[model samples]
Target: MDPPSSSSSERWLWWMDDEKKHSIADTIDIEKSEDGEKIDARKERIRDCMTVLGGFLSIMATGGAINSVGLLQTHWENNQLREYSPQTVGWIAGTNIFLSLFVPVLAGPVFDRYGHIWILAVGSGLFVVGLFIISFFDNHSAAPVTLGMMISSWGVLCGTGYGLIQTAVPGVICRRFDRRRGLANGFSSLGNSVGGVLWPMLLRVALERLGWSWSMRAIDGLALVMLAIGNGLMWGSGVPAVGIAARPEPESSDNEKNKEEQEEEGREPSLTWGQCIRDGARCFRKGDFVWMTASLAIFQFVVMGVAGTLPSWGQQQGFEDASLFFYVVAVVNAGAAAGRVVVGSISDSLGRFNSVIIVQTMVVIVGFGIWHNVGTNERLLYVFAALWGFSNGAILGLWSPLVGECVHTPAPDHIHAIIESLRLLTELVCGVSRLCDVENFGRYLSAASSVVSIAGLLCVPSSAQILGTLGPDIHVIFFGTLLILSLMFMVMARVTFTGYSFKIWRVV
Candidate 1:
């Protein structure tokens, strides 16, 4: 039952050492777990569930609410602030998005070292402060006001509050469930979907009915409600019970053998400012990391491209209501929520890497292209948004689980942190700046998005079969047999290629 201390490289120390397993399970005190010492689990599932609910709310409150900017650019342009360069205004969001990713690794580790109570409280304050800044700040300042405000709400405050909760909630529920990890994660991821559904509509109504400031403050109110509930969840039920805290037995001696290799590598560095730069460089170097990040980044780029320009694209093609934008965001978020649960559950049965490759391929073809084309047809436009929404929603949730698969047999902590870190780096980028006027720029944006996403998809893990090299035929064949193969890997991580032996790739 003892884990091999010989290998402790990938964050799953439990798999490597007997004592480390205690930290993940019930033996440690939630309070004591923060101080480089093991403690105990509270054994409270109901409260843990509440913590997850709170997390869902917080993510929903913040996740898609601010993404409304692509839609908001028009208003900003029409306002006196029309002088604000697209890049300059983008810094507001870009900063928010970037920091929201980066600051969290440090915070997540700290939450591991400390606890969620203070982190949540502080993060909630930042969220409120951010909301106030957005609601009240006039962009008349000589400096970029939107940029400044986003950093406050989006970067520092949301990063801190949400970061704390994001780390804490799963830690809590994970302690509570063995049979339901996917369901737990899925349930928690839904908050954003719920918010995605509500926020845009609220933004529209409030802008016309309550005005920008009030509408934003109204968002603040909603945040407060979510946080209050989150507080209850963290405070009451975030730890595991005693008996369940025991170290889990390995599935086989092979797990121990894997642990032996890991113990030699040690833990991930507490990434300093320099580590961030290196991560970008390293992301390029590691084949798996490079391909994975590109795949995910292209997904986001497409998302931004679609989000920013889709309405215009729809308008251009003569399906003119701006209403579809919000609906798309909502549907995408909802689908993402569903994707996380379903896909995650599949990962349990299938391999994580396989499920993602399969799902992402479908996402590109069906969710983005086919669905998009159909949307252009008189009736399918709205349906297209709904379809895209479902697929996109799953993409974000896929990160953590995919990370779990990619770096299997590691200490869960380290694996989780790395996954989160890469996400942060991507969010931090300045991105290619937009030049033409907003509307025209949108068309260029979506086209560029499509192109990039297609390029990203070029390296689908097993494309050598048909194209002989990573190329267009591979891209064209996206929704076909490869998808089934990818899905097959989920259930049966084995290659079915004829004449080719299974030794090479059946288990990846």
Candidate 2:
């Protein structure tokens, strides 16, 4: 009745149980027992929902646009940029992809020191403004889109905007939700898939009737609306309305507990930039964290190849119509949307690392078995797109939750001391349970993104060369092989974290 005052494990179980006991009668009983506590809990739940909504809308604008790059590439090559080679055009997309990921290195630390509101506002402005500027440079205009124009607007401005939004959205989620983090992230990530499907369809229709100039503007208008609503909801939502109690590490000493309480009471000093950098650096030292980053980086390379080139490969196989490529992109994103929700839900019970290992196997299978063999058959290509999208979506959606787990995991060497430090850090930064150090999460996320951005920068351009010099068949083989290697790293990460003991299968 009075919010569980028992041990941390029992408190955690109580929260889970309370979630299940959802009924009007139960609500009435809770309110009757403690009006103030019940009201606070209700407010917290509402804020959590708002945070998820904000994340979904924000991701739809940013990540969803990124997902639609393949469609944009097809448009550019066919119409305005037909004179250039695929490899050359790829540099534009590569630049966008690179900035979208790489700018997070700066955004993450800035987010920790500042907050999310201004970051979201600035990012949304840049992204929308870039889109508007690009519309004027469309083939319909006097000054058609040039390499410099494309790179400057989409690559530099929009990409930097995306990086900032992406960093802030997840940081807020990590602070608010703990046990249900995977599910929350999954729901938020679903926005990208939805955006992927919607953007292509809208662009296809607009391109047919309105032409390229208005099509870009139309989507930019929609993006502006979505981003505005997202920013409004996300502002001032980082700190949880109710304190989520976390079980202290069993090894924590009384002094450590005292320090944690003091930090929770807002006595902790403002973290210096050096301290922020040092904390993020510590993540690299953990075997599991390092292995996990490598796994994600390699798999990201695979994803970039598939997302950027699959439609082009279809065009090469005699399906030249842009309309059909639109359908292909849509189907893949539809499958991805389903996968994010389904996989995120299951990861809570099955374990984050285990869920990735399972899904990534399918990624490998689809890459080698399905995509490699599909040549001229339109139906087979569609099938491959769907399967690839679904499996790949699951793997991509798990990265945030996996990173959260790694940050929370006790360091391999220090054990007790690191646990205490992390606990203190969590309370000091987020005023929530032992999920992750919210202030430092951006940097860890940035570290992972650093590797991913490199993959993004190279995968499309390099794959285009492979497509030209060799063939789509050889490109598939290369992509599939990378997936296999990444899968191995995933297993290594799991083992390194849980160890070789019987506790290997423990819900990690």
Candidate 3:
């Protein structure tokens, strides 16, 4: 072959690059075509549907671990840390709950930008490590680790891992499902309820047979097995790969090129972090986002608070049998699981906002009408747990779809979804704070929870303080009031977004 001229070599390289670009483009097109075809496929072939079962199980594991903190809290109080104040012990579980909720804000963006594999890998590792750490901690040692130390090791570490997985799983479903998005989300959320039901019984059994340390280890082992299986399923799901760039089409001719150049010059530059912050601030200023955020925040604050405290409250109610006390938590969660499926399925038909309103109304009625009056009557307490659990579960299941509806712009974009997700996740941080006893323990726990109808807003220590100082009757009233206020906010959000027409049953 004769030596090519520089111009000819340049032409050859350009042609190669063009060929490569076309190949990339073709790959993307094939991927998109496959996605579309899968969307139209029979239910069995849909990757999203295939993964839903695994995702549900993954979420069930996550929820089980997170919600099981109540059982752990009760165990620690009654067995491991009898001398410690309830408020002091409460921080351990509270921090775990707080971090699990808050870390999702950070995780969501990452999940959106990256795919599930690395996130799941890191999350599973951290989650397993956190569980192992909790399992190995020995209270009988010469220098027993303090409650604060446990919080750092178990709460922060495990919670972070939980947050990563929790955020990623739902984001996967969100990207996968379109027509059945609500139902898909609902199924995933049902995992939390399932966890709530199963973990208590499991933990109680472990506590009875294995003791606290070994019980944690047993749970850890279960988590390890489940996460391994879930991770495998996730790896195989063939969800879209991230970070691939789509090739821009070639511009034709000088006049066309000139128009494109001019349009590019006119377009807004990519957003800077400062600009994004400013934009998010502006979005939050809008009434719809604010009200929706507030309602969601209050609901989470109350529900999580209640969930964390419920086992302890059952103990305080003179439920001497530890098994029964744990079962109370299970019953509530069981009801919630049922609610998640039923409410989630219906939300697609009934307006998301309307469904939430109905659920919240039921929560208020349960909190005040049933929960407030239930004394030592075990049957009534179980009834209250069932009703409250169902209503609250429905709220949790519906909130995501509701937020999606409220913040949804006409033409959907990643930035908008990220903003909405961030807003919703960030708002839950407020509820997380309410789970622990900060400086304003009694007032914040009692007043905010009551006003917002945050069901289980009382931290263990604070619940102890309130139950001791103010009485359980007062605590019940606080929760009832919180439910009432939460109901009002839900109503306000619905009215603000959907208008006053009763005919519009479906808000989302």
Candidate 4:
């Protein structure tokens, strides 16, 4: 007899194996029909492009604004909230940073189930409205901007909106692309960097020429346009038909159908609220997950801590030209944008966990070697900003993708909950829809965010208080120690992930 075709041979093997049953149908590779495969490949590429483009635009508006908090801190202190102490004024920016990360805790699970449309809509609306409200008050007006107004409009509203948009962008990207996930996230994140560069320049010019009212309104208008177009493109971006992508879907025999029916009958009808909490808690049982969360939380603290107080530290360093501070913010973000793309691409090849170890080491070296010594040298300050931004960009770009990687391998569980719940919580540390499915990336991401966002909330004000009480030199050491702490946690996470293997070349 002639040898069977490759597809037929695979099917024969699958049929012969009784232990290899799956509830979901697999993605069929119609290799016998070349035309069908070509069409599917073409369609998949097109969809991926649309999603990336949409993510770029949305993240530009959200991430760009969030990254610009350092600039805002300097502006408010000099113009509107000048009378307030730096530590007090830092609260406004701190609250904004806090909400931007924290609100995602709620938005993540919602995005996993319902898709990105409604959440993005709500996020876009809140974002624009916050800026619009802020436009009405400035120093020259009868009703000047107050700390309360800034906190409510800028901090709470804009931050919450950004949290949703930020979550949705990475969540969809992770779902669509697995192997090239780091590249996709890095490229789309360029929007934030671009926004970071552009927003500072735009605000500086607008503030000088048009005053605060018009400047806020201008950003509000631009954000609305960018977000609207982005929302349209991301309409179809959500959980796809998840299964074994290489396996062909075969016609079910009578016996196979009966077996599936019996399996379905044995599953629970529904998962209760208590079960959901229990499953979420189980995710923390993994040492790798816990270490990763600790590292990210410290990362958040370092980022917000620096952004909140960097401008004030510059002023203290005796920089006479205030405009230079704005330029520094722009340049830092420019370096960050470059870093996200470069290091992000590198992570794809170098392994995400390995890249983390490398970048964090660079951060610690720069933090002590350069940043600690740059006193009055403007050139050194600029160099530090560029180098720090580049290294820090990797942290932001790789974080969600790292979570995606960690959540891919779920531990065995014997829970009797609904099939949906089990799929969503296979590892029970970070929620995965199935053992390795991308459907519930949001839940995994949210679980990680919840653990880290508190750092964002407290770090800014705390940093300012430290700067006030001790001085620039002491503050630098404080933040540097935090970086070391973060690096230690990342190392521990890598060790746990690798099962303490001595082979360093292994791709995590």
How many clashing residue pairs are found in candidate 1? 34
lDDT of 4 by residue, 1-508 (tens): 3333445434444444334322111223344467787898898888888889999999898788888888788788787787777788788878888888878776655665566677788999999999898787677233235778988989889998998898778777877898888668767878988988888888888888988888898888999999998888787665442222212333467767745654554311233446545665666666677788899899889887897788888887778877787788888899988888787777878999889889999999999999999988889999999998998887877887788776776443344457435334544655322223464454567677777778888887898889878999999999999999999998888766654443568666
* lDDT tens readout by residue for model 2, 28-74: 55666698888889988898899899999999987777888888877
Q: Pick the candidate with the highest TM-score.
A: 2
Regions of model 1 farther than 4 Å from truth: 1-45, 66-69, 73-75, 78-80, 138-147, 150-156, 159-161, 175-179, 238-286, 308-319, 371-378, 409-508
lDDT against true structure, model 4: 0.77
Off by over 4 Å in 3: 1-50, 138-144, 241-276, 408-465, 498-508
lDDT of 3 at 199: 88
In terms of TM-score, how similar is model 1 to the real structure? 0.61
The reply for model 4, stretches above 4 Å from the true place, is 1-48, 140-145, 172-183, 236-276, 408-443, 501-507
Query: Across residues 1-508, which tens digit of lDDT does each residue of candidate 1 receive?
Result: 5454543332345443555565554444454456534222333444556766766766676665545544554444334245655434444444444445444555544554455566666776777776777676545563455556655665456545555555556655665567876677677767666776677777777777886678778878977787777666656653532222122433456866646544443222233446544433332332333344445555554554445434433444455665656565555556656665666566655555555656666665664366535534645655656656655665556665443333322221223565545534543562311112222221222222233333322322122222223333333344333333334433322221111123333333
Cα lDDT of all candidates, in order? 0.50, 0.77, 0.66, 0.77
- The TM-score obtained by model 4 is 0.77
Tell me each candidate's TM-score: 0.61, 0.77, 0.74, 0.77
Clash pairs of candidate 2?
Answer: none
Tens digit of per-residue lDDT, candidate 3, span 26-93: 67668888998786775545566667877887777777877767677766676667777767777777
Q: Estimate the overall C-alpha local distance difference test score of candidate 1.
A: 0.50
